[model samples]
Target chain A: MAKSIESLIPLSETAYYILLSLNVPRHGYGIIKYVEKLTGSRIKLGSGTVYTTLGKMSKVKVISVYQDRDRKTVYELTVEGSKLLELEINRIKIVYKDTLYQEGLFNEQK
Target chain B: MSKNKFRPFWSYDVLKTQDWLNDLSFKGYKLIKVNPVLRIFQFNKSESENKKHIINYDKGLDGYPIYIKDGNDYTEICYTKNFYFLEQISDEPNSVPSYNDLVSRNRKIKYIVGQMLLFQIMLYSFFILIVIIFTLGIGSVTVESIPSNEVEYTTIEIMSAIAFILVNFGYFIIQIWMIYSFFRLRVSNRKLEVFCGDGIDMSFTIPKDTILTKEEIRKLRKEKKLIKKTKVAWFYSPDKIEDWLEQMELKGFNLIRMSKIGNSFYFKTGLPRNVKYHVDFQTKKGANYFSLNKESGWKLYFTSYSRFMAISVWGQEYTELVPKYYSDHETKVKHAKKYMWTYLAVFLPAILFVVLSIGMSITLFAYANFENISTWMILSPLIMLVLVVELLFFCFKVIRYYSRVKATEL
Candidate 1:
């Protein structure tokens, strides 16, 4: 049975960035570079971290793996994975809104 | 002028050979050619400055040398089999070219080791067969069957036999020494892997510069009450061994170090704690493999020498929620299968050898008279029978572990 999308909720920072970068199929090194770029150099995923994360996500069917033309192992997010990403983005939006509202109140009180 | 030197077994210890070559270059003798078959080194005397020599085992894709063209600093001096002798003219030590792919380099070493082991096994089997034949000829003949006068061997024949035995004994000693050197090479290769990273990416090598002095080490050792224990053939069943180590930690024996070959484990007495142990097998590990695991707080205890199916022991202390090295069921099952197949491959040939010996002895007993059969012949097969049974048991344990992992959903 496929695991519920909710069970994989609260994706790790590494896992979230990895899934986000997997919009297009990418190999291990490619994903590392993509994640570094996507995060504006804030996150540089090590090859081992990418490899283990891809393995775990592949196990849960959140990501699918295939061999590219050059025989490199490439990964891309699955349909369930896209949905999980969307859910995470929505959750973040709520937190972002609350923080902004609190900042406005603090400014008014000052 | 060219000078020739004979070093019959130089390739067995490559690092030492490299150092020797470098030393020669410093003395103005430049390597011209290597006669691998004849075990000779040809050098030409030159007034050139000291140049660095790098011996690389070239494993190129599609049967070609990887470093075909000369780089900016280093040029190929000569080629012999898979080894390419490279020379750097620049005096700067840091500018000298070296292998960046440690995993590939170690794989080549593993290949050489495998070939040497195969040769040794063949030599040993032939030697044993000759010994068995001689013993049978001398011990099985009855006194009544012999002529009234004992048959005498010629002095030349006796002398030849003595020489042959001496040669074989010397060869046997050389083989033992070669085995020891191979172990030393493995230890050094693993150290290189850990300290130098792949050279392509960032390295997270544990600093060795902060090493404790002898007196400090002795003081620390006394305070910790360090103890050492040896366990042979631990790789045959690594999972059980990991559990055993973890259990020992719970009993206040925290594992501090493991010997180079992963046989001897050193521990220091400490408070009872929960520590998860993982036995990871990887065919090749990149710099990222070490960096990522280290970043995740897993302390690397031991890593086997061969990059081809290398085994590493990693441990992490936790108060709760046992950490999973492979958080997924698929990866865990795959790891178990790797253990099963590796042991199966290693033990299958051993089992066949044992079976063949037993079969040969049985046939010998059936064809020959009971009185003619020697006790030694019978004893040899009996010993092999016990060995085959033990090997089969180990195979069973590995298979069972694989099946258990396969059945488990997690």
Candidate 2:
């Protein structure tokens, strides 16, 4: 039960999906649909959760959001988001390379 | 008690009449049923309040012993899983405001659910309309068999019709749920005053002409006066209708409780161990005898719930028992999404089936005949990839709405 509250910290799944969804400048709803398509209908974000997360992410410089004359905040990943992606890729590579070496397949593959 | 003070309203939603043999106590009676959304309880009292001289009021620790706290002398009234409800009754003249506040919590929840239901209906109807419009063009798509040069009608019409019916059937289900919620909301609102200790009614429909004597009108006037309109704020059964009546009768004075046996209402009243029976004829509108409507006064109702007759009691000071088992929106949303793990069970299979279907459909139409078989064979995987992408896009749209489900408590 205590674990559930900790799991809902919002910056992980919501942030990742929103960042990926808005490869182009997209508004709140358009991001929702894009994420749905990307995930093959796996992740559905409630409207409240969506807006709240977007507001938080924007404040932290993870994603940049601006109004496109129509006054709807169209959101897109920023340089900071790319930095996050690089960090994630490096960590994954370390883990994957370590596993590959431990399994002794690196000798043949390399 | 201050009529406007917000108090703790305990609610535990358990199935009807099933034994909740957890740690619980009853000084006055054993609880029968509790509806959190309605904010009411049904219980069976072994003794009546009128005859019992020593009516001990306790700020008793729930799931423990009930005692009369007179200078710290705590007496255990009874040891059982009988429900004791904690509800504030307004000592003030006006009680609506306090009562409304309590009832409003439920009202807000009910309203949100109703809005969501209406949204679902609109969406279902929109899908059904699409299916119908597509069906209109289905008949025009005729097929000619290239091999035999024979005619064959496309099955698009049949598929369209089936899809239309399925959408309507889904809408029908939502309609039933909407109706049930509507009636439940109405009942909960109407019954608020009874458990609040003031028979509250802001508007009264007193008849202009009466066939009965002046005495009858006076009685109603008395009842109307009992109906306190001044809002002392804070808002907010089953049964063995007879056994409870007999017990109430033994204690003296007549006892009345409200029960619903279908669409209509039934009033079960008892006169001091004398006799117990149904008294629907004595009721007005759907109101039970005096206060025997859903939140009727000082009464217990036994209902056949789950498997046994669940008993519910309403009495003075503590009017209703709402057991909070701690399920909320988050719980439900969590529960729905928790099955995401279960998606693993079908995820691989569904993907494989889709991939296989694409592969077969592509292979079956090599060159659209046979002369250009090699050319079409080379194009097959590309066509399959395009089809798969379209299918995935459609699937994703539907799945996204259902994904990220919020947890709900039961």
Which TM-score values does chain B get in all models? 0.55, 0.24
- Model 2: residue A76 alpha-carbon error in angstroms: 54
Fraction of true interface contacts that also occur in model 1: 0.03
lDDT of 1 at B152: 84
- Give lDDT: candidate 1, residue B204: 29
The docking category that best describes candidate 2 is incorrect
Worst 10 residues of 2 chain B by lDDT: B228-237
Candidate 1: residue B329 Cα off by (Å): 1.0
Please give, for residues B295-376, the per-residue lDDT of candidate 1 as tens digits: 5568788776565548878888998767667655655776788778987998999899889989998888889887888888
**Model 1 misplaced stretches (Cα beyond 4 Å):** A1-110, B1-224, B229-232, B307-309
Q: Candidate 1: TM-score?
A: 0.50
RMSD of each: 13.7, 30.2
DockQ of 1: 0.04
